[model samples]
Target chain A: MKLHNPITLLLSLTALLLSQQSIAAPVEYIFINLWDEYVQQTPLPDPHPDIERRFLHPDINIDKPSVDQFTALFPVYDGLKIDTHNQLAIRYGVRQTPYRLVVEGKKVITREALIKAPLAAHADQPAQDQTLQTLSGHPFDPTRPGAGFRVLFFSDSLCPFQHIPNCERRIAQNNHLSANIDYPVITVIKPFYVDHTQVSAYQQRFNVNHEIVFDSHNQLFRRFEVTDLPYWVVQNRQGKVIYRANQVPPLPL
Target chain B: METIMKTNLKTFLTGIVLLALSATASAKPYPPLQARTLADQPISSSGKITYLKFWATWCAYCVEEMPLLQQAFENSQESYQVIAVNVGFNQTVKGVKTYLNRYGYRFPTVFDASGSITRQYRVTGTPQHILLDASGKEIYRSALLTDELRQHLATLTGDKL
Candidate 1:
């Protein structure tokens, strides 16, 4: 006549909550500002008015290279990881001052785009699979349709700032994933500074023993809309994109 | 009575004119790009379909793709304008000119000394191609000479190449 055992029900509820948390990855807003020292401290034009109104508080200042300032401004957000060396800015390829982005679980959204549309509209967009020639001289399709979780790692061999801690850690994580049999990882090199011939050396240099594909013509970048380096996207067996972030996300349990 | 009717008609016409002006003003034009070329010539889109190629002197891919851009420039002569913008990343004006002269590539070049124009377009990498239609709306953007870019150019200018 009892509905359930109290101890068993409590454990079941905890497991249910943990499962939900993993499924719903945390959404973070990463704001990268060009340091004043990098460029002459000239009076810059005001950012887009909507940027001020929607994304930032009026009192929070930007364009200064100070960890204290960022920490003070973004005290509440867990995703506000400070990069004192401006490595994140370089990784995101920030050419302008005060670049802002919304990392909603897997999707990277721009400030203006996010303002115009709801996050749901930008969610679960499928990553496009292109036929690329792998280092082994075979046409490789990254989107292993109906396979287990496929890890697409976007790395740049010639990235000047690849030595940075965050970048190095991401590379190490990929290397570890490369050896793992559960995740079929493919390192997609940026075509800007990398050619197919250099792919082998990149592998040897970084000890990236996994499948390396040179994204020729940048079709994959355009299709996936990824502009940053050391990025990762994980797609499930059904080819449904579950997660994508600048840094590697944890593998689903 | 005739005078009164004429006054009302004049007021209605003014209202319509103001409405039309507001509509056009609200239709945002593309970001403005006005700069002097390395050869000291002023260049702007000037209501023409303009192609912007963001490149740096040190970028190897940019060096390799210059010839294709030169051909595109020569082919889309009257129908479109091509402006090669030096991204101004640790590059000097003299170095850019020397490189251009060495190659004998004569497309209009803008040395974005302060990276103002480059920042405006948010160009992250070199050899980035951006094509705008005559109306100044960006029609295409790519990192390489893709067939899609060629198709966009062909459709816009009726140029087979």
Candidate 2:
């Protein structure tokens, strides 16, 4: 076998180089960090910096989201956008501060998954469907396509201030808003310090006409990444989020 | 026309005064805080006004304001006490230690590993400053370190900003 032929040697070297290059190629990532400046200042148990720092490689690009809306009821700073609806936060299902989303090619690896194992070998999987039930015991899936546009109204029966009458008024205002909306609105009661009985009582007290779902385990809250109460997410018939805001948006007349 | 202008100005001024009054009235008592310091020491309640600052290493503004905070902490030693609360989002105790050591910030820090203290205070974001009086009444809460805060500090510490 004449293995020393110039053409054969060149082909062999070229194959070896191609294989090495493929092995050495670094994966590129876009690191989207969704964080609040105030929350960053406030004392909270955040993700470990060491774990998060793994994404800060040369191949990873950092992207900081911009604030577009004035969301604070009482503006803390001249440009503070607290309570404002952030598109990236909603898109990534971010609930806590310093939330990291690593986008590599077509796969998006979450902080929780990235911290657990090696990112290079990890396979992208579809999100698990959470089992949800309505107050009437019927199975409810927010992702399932319905006939018309659906409104997810994340509400807390009692405000953080339980004693204040303004809390009641706020609940009434939300209920009224839901009643007026042309789209089918589903009221999801928060699981934090709230119970099914409180939701039922709230329905009666506020005369909430829409279907009320008690998120006993905060499954829906986690699914929607709802950080604040009185949050609204509008989804089209195809179950895609078209609009979301902390404050209810004016619907079509 | 001059009288009408004066009347309009009076209404606007009265509205501003009422708004200020309402703001003062709305200042609620500071919620009770329970947490351990960086040294794992439990915080003891004091009669002096408490200045709570929430900060994280990831927040550029929080890091930028650290020097000012340290200065305020040093100056207000007699009149008020400053507690730097590390909003532990994406931060570890060891990481916080390294940061403080690197910057030489000696202000007392509390690692909110559970974020309970922040939640109790309803802190929405970082660099949140809360000034509580001797009776634990929240006198001021703001995201930005305003001139008013500086004046208040100067008045209490007797050190002009």
Candidate 3:
């Protein structure tokens, strides 16, 4: 098998190996990477270059995804759409992603909050479908200290909003929002996305300073359901999606 | 004498207006770029179609329905070729390589360094399809390519433009 298509090769190998092993053994493992979720939340980061070099070195152990191995670990999910999975992680009666569901047959078995541990049974759906309150990942009082709004800024140093050739008005469209308003915006710096230089240039030119977070694994982007780049989601002082200019919905096809 | 003065003033105003109009007409709303590849190769000629589909490895829509595009490419490569350009100007070659390998996106991807092609084509989002003619003129544009479009392309190019 060609090394370029190692994912398909691994799947094929698993099938053959499983057939030879005892029936009691686990079937096979598929890592449903959610990098797409992260690409929309922040720009690529500094550690990306060193991490990327290790991925293409041809000597590293790629058996499992590790934080320092963003390049190789994420290829399994490259060019993949978000429709194959659901917004699995939910809080305050909301579901979110990084969700793993194990199925043996037609019946639903279990769903565990943990990814390392596979679930034995699927839990029943929640009774209440609608909760009037805004979305909050953590349960905290809105009036408490540091309990302000969370501005999930999905940007990439590589795909900066500036110099977007004018055709990509979305970048300017996302930038037009008045950030001088009330609560602060949490900017997630995703430097390793489509292009890092552009993102860097934009940050330098704009002189952005805010609640900056890093998503080396892209976990936070998937949580907010952002699809397109230069996306902005406004969570209230209570951490709810009050307004989002680029909230990517589920795939139609 | 007063009428002559008024006529000359009107003539001067008309000259100013004409110059302004001509200058604006010559200026490009989005000027063409001089982006060169790693080997200093100029950007390849965009195939004849009205709408050009620009996508990136980071764009989810571009990745998900990739196999469908491959099918389209295979079905009608002779008469019509869909150039799925990759916006890797800001991304590393290795990162983009991983993405291309993962999705099996084996199309003739033209790289955008200074975003000249993006501006020239007037593309705003990923997975956007522009249909151009034989002389490189845009005729149709859409954010998403539907099944009906695939069918229509099949009929238009006799294979699929």
Candidate 4:
């Protein structure tokens, strides 16, 4: 019964347990803040006195309802206060403020800032096997069951609205429909110079409600052969492109 | 005899786990970038500090900030290379040239017509500044032109702000 034997046994047991835990529990949630200043800003209008008090005093044990509501939607929310100084910010391509990116682990689950705009309502087509990450870092396979028809929106965040005013108007109209419609929309933001932060600001300004994804590397855009800003492609549950257009489609009565 | 074998096995497993963890902690290196200037000359980072400024003809902020970038570029003097990358999202080379001519500030300008370079750098807006160190690692970045940044650039280049 040498001391080395017991020490080695303990180390082995610890390593085995840790490895098992790592394999079992992937990082379920990551909430990245493109800009810390904007994240600190109140999203709610006319904050409750208790909430204000909590902000003033972090040491206070008082429960804030607003914070509780947000936490309820995301149990394990971790904010990455990113700036130009942060290397991760550059790595992730955060261009603007109030970028709320949710990831399950390595994959992006959804982006709060990207929204979809329907170009046309057409016959069913097969869905494409596009592996996108959700805001919560989950792998979102459009072909998966319950993923319904997806409205694939291809748009540039830095597209000059001055020259193409129609594009801007269409985006506004599409933003409205995406917010009100119950269909599954997947918006692919074409990376220009704009990052998640700028995209978040754009989403806020337009009040968009689609699962935004970044095509920063332009792999998806190239695959789709979309060169224009604010392009829309409709895909059926089976992952096939059915309809593609440059304008927003008319909503059914 | 069995206990001695178990101890060796455990030690080996622990070492493997530590190695895996260490590998994950290291940051990935920056990707290579190649582009042409407005003068049609090839400009790239050759293991020297590089400054990339993303701008656009339509962005008033970008237009206004061009002079500061020019000053920084001129003052840099062999210490660093400054590149004014025009984000050509719905823009033309003529428009960019007009703006450059009006400003008369000629520090190597590059056009991101297809937005490939912009996407690589992850620039989200105009007047975005990114500073890469000699090893091509991103050292600093900012979306705004501030006095503090000017001071920092001055210190890095040994030039008067």
RMSD (CA, Å), each prediction: 22.0, 26.8, 22.9, 24.2
Report DockQ per prediction, comma-separated.
Answer: 0.02, 0.02, 0.02, 0.01
Ranked by lDDT from best down, the candidates are: 1, 2, 4, 3
lDDT score of model 4? 0.57
RMSD of 2: 26.8
lDDT of 2 by residue, A1-253 (tens): 6549898899999999998765554332222232233222222234344332222211000111122211232132223223322333334444343334544433454443123211110001222446777787877788873788888887776543321224455566667877776777788886533457668877887788778888766667657755444677888888888876656657752
What lDDT is reached at residue B144 by model 2? 46
Ranking by TM-score: 1, 2, 4, 3
Candidate 3's TM-score reads 0.32
Each candidate structure's TM-score, on Cα atoms with residue i matched to residue i, is 0.40, 0.39, 0.32, 0.35
Please identify model 4 stretches exceeding 4 Å from their true place: A1-253, B1-27
Docking class of 2: incorrect
lDDT of 2 by residue, B33-71 (tens): 656789787773346688899887765436656777898
> Model 4: number of clashes?
32
TM-score (0 to 1) for chain B of model 4: 0.79
How would you encode candidate 1's per-residue C-alpha lDDT over A119-185 as one tens digit per residue? Answer: 1101113334456777877676645534588888887765434112266677888898778657778
lDDT preference between candidates 2 and 4, better one: 2
Candidate 1, number of clashes: 1
Candidate 2 local Cα displacement, residue A52, angstroms: 25
